[model samples]
Target: MKNLLFTVFTVAALFSACTNDADVKTFVNANGYTIYNDSLISFQKMIIEDGKVRQVGGEELSEMGEVIDVQGKTILPGLIDAHAHVMGLGFQELNINVAGIETLEATLDSIKAYAEANPELEWIQGRGWNQTLWPENEFPTAADLDKVVPDRPVWLTRVDGHAGWGNTKAMEMANISQDTPDPQGGKVIRDRTGKATGVFIDAAESYVTQHIPAPTAEERRLALEKALEKMASEGITSVHDAGIPAQTWELYKKFADEGNMITRIYAMIGGTGNDFDELSKNGPIKSYANDRLALRSVKISADGALGSRGAAMKEPYSDDPGNRGLLFYEQDELNEMVDKSVSNGYQTNIHAIGDRANDVVLNAFEQAIDEFGDQGLRHRIEHAQIVSLEDIPRFKELDLIASMQATHATSDMNMAEDRVGSERIKGGYAWQKFLDQGTVIANGSDFPVEHVNPFFGLYSSVTRQDHEGNPPNGWYPEERLSREETLRSFTLDAAFAAHQEDVLGSLEPGKWADFIIIDRDFFEVPAIEIWQTKVLETWVAGDKVYGNSD
Candidate 1:
């Protein structure tokens, strides 16, 4: 009798939902979990029309087209990763990934194996290598790589993508030698005799990359497609593709038109590219395939990564006192860059991982905002990872968003304290402090560097511990964000950072029906178990992108 009754109601709802609107869809009997006004709420039914959320949780909710019984599973706004390299993740799939390899021998063996299998390849290109995990905790030289692949150039980026390791073949091919002076804002990693050691930090990476053979347009397209599919399967509805070159912009447009863009992309123009002039003069491109693609932001790198010891610290590294790390641009240069970007109507996001870099960039933003009269522009500081106590409240004062990666704290737990010393470490990864001052934090995984799972980021943000539950009380436990705050960091807050909150983030009316269903309610789960939560379904624009064939 119960089965018969459900079947009859489903048919009636389906007929009613499918009335005038061909695209109208109704989801009923859902947990319909969502965050509104900083609190979690649940709705039992929702109506989607014209790819927008038409109504949410009303007893009189009229079904429009097709009706789906979510079976009371936990539903949430589709996850959006505020920081990631989408194209690079796809290429990582195509190349060698030595991400979690712990030992130097394992890394060399993997490179050798990859080269042996792909004899047709011109060069060996891959990422995710951290020398700090090695016994010596020192940078590897070309000689180390030459021991594995002397015949061809091997270029592997450090896990953070801020530094790179190359073999002798790569340096030689690029004409790097003892005479090659270090590029400004970059390091050549020279020996005592001043010979180039095939390790490039920050801006210096361009030297070898410029020499590398570019991926063919088809190869890039394939990579983008792979990334899009992977994101959908992972229950990600939107990805902020960190810094994309001009060539990729054309491909993004093509994919959006053809409806291959299962996941929406909010991109930032690469500052190093020459296409800035054309893009800046034309201002932002806000309406691409009804916001499936958006490019209104410019990405600027103020410094390098913490792991590489290339994040310009206010004081010299505790472990390596001689090194204070690299700063990409002087304040004057940064001020000019911010001025140009904001004046032409672009939101500027600078990568600042260290206290020194954050302070410098903040100063630059302050001066630029003053000069440009930025009206409600949410300029951003990406990876506002390590900051000083005095400069903490300035984020709120300046109305700047702290774009952070939650998993970074867990990943760097062991080394972060030793590198910065206990005093400075207090203000590092200070999520709670930022929140107390009413500063918005947009959280994500710097994927392909950390794991791509959004759950991992949420777990780290809420628990401040690694997967094993280390650091008894959590590393800087007071700095951890509550579960409520962390969810906002990933959802509504992330959308706000990309200037898409009105349509993309929440599961409320007038927003795109982009949401996911999970096996368990994140709020109901034990904090330690959050990372293990599985996504059952992902829907975008009222269409199921992953899971549930019906």
Candidate 2:
């Protein structure tokens, strides 16, 4: 379920591009094109052989190979979601998607509907609920959910995935009560009466999720299948699987061995400190299934999310002045762990949100690099969402990657300034600032948090506005990236983050035969139409994997 191509050229219209006369498939007649090196290239034809790019030239080159027609669509490097959850996307489809619902009633209604439809489910699981979109912007209590599905456990993750709201039954199943102490780096929000509101934040969310039944292997395999299919349809050829448990990584390997792998995954072995320690001792898993999978990265979390009031902050919150946030580790502890991991050659990707978290992580990265020297593993700080103004350039100085999500900017614009205050907001979602300093900003949609659509990210990055073109101008117009810059971030720079730049990321010679054909010229189209540009065909390794099925 990777990308696919359509409108196959009649074999009679082509010849071999190379003298070797190997099995060659030629793609020609694109209305506009771009490759890794240039935003716009003069070439109109490309040749693929043995699942690798063989040649790219003008119409003359097209005459040498069996021409495959693109029907005058725009061709681009298959988009890579630099940071996304692979299986989370599939589960989003399998379970409830309460993503764009505008009101509280709609959220409860969705849960009720899903519960009614799947009565056999002991626990109704879903995500993408945000109180920020609600009328009062107040957290919903368990009583609100109890009004609907009170029989079974209901666990709904907040849109940011940093918090969870559960029904009374769910919390009871976990034995959470007013007396239950919040976990380190987490919270169990309470009301004026000090009753458990059934809202868990950051690490505190484990209280309920740990009790939820794990999906069966077959179920996981199916979710992955569904996930890859969804990814392919979106013109996503490859993704950096944000973090997954060992079982999930093994499941990915099983699929790769079965030759069922379509969407390429650069997996990060995910777990708690113990799991990470064990995995580190066992060491990284570099390549599997002909490089279709690479599990050589470790994911760590520095703090919670800003929306959940869990992200570690240097100062008190602007809106809630009395409350600062939680940090998962002390500076030295985090530094020691990161230093060892990088010294072991594993790409350490840390989830850092608040300025304090970013600052701490950045300092740790600098210390680790100083101690170990550069391993060129391109260690990344995921969701470098809100770096302090003083620490913005530290990303480039330390050679640490700011693996960010563009959609997060537009998604958070509504409540962000209110949370961080106007002065601190200057450093939040500062993409253009990073770019100007030559920091390779790897962009993505932290999928399952935002939409999986890369175009939405592209739209957000270029416009710094939500899909409806809100705020008249962008929320922070000065921070918007150029169209070419955003594309490069999603493609080449994304590959660079995964250490796959030489093999993927572009439609250049000697690279993987990965490219996507879209319905509209992304560059020439009006900015408003950018998100409307649909994937007409997606191809991986010269094989078509998706067409306009609908």
What TM-score would each prediction reach against the true structure?
Answer: 0.94, 0.94
List ranges where model 1 is wrong by over 4 Å: 1-22, 58-64, 548-550
Model 1 Cα lDDT, one tens digit per residue, 111-146: 999999999888999999988787877888899999
lDDT of each: 0.85, 0.84
Q: In model 2, what is the error at residue 316, expressed in angstroms? A: 1.1
After superposing candidate 2, which stretches have Cα over 4 Å from the reference?
Answer: 1-22, 271-274, 277-282
Distance (Å) between predicted and true CA of 239, model 2? 0.4
Model 1: worst 10 consecutive residues (lDDT sum): 2-11
Per-residue error (Å), model 1, residue 314: 2.0
Q: What is the number of backbone collisions in each predicted candidate, taken in the order shown?
A: 5, 10
TM-score of 2: 0.94
Question: Best candidate per TM-score, number?
Answer: 2
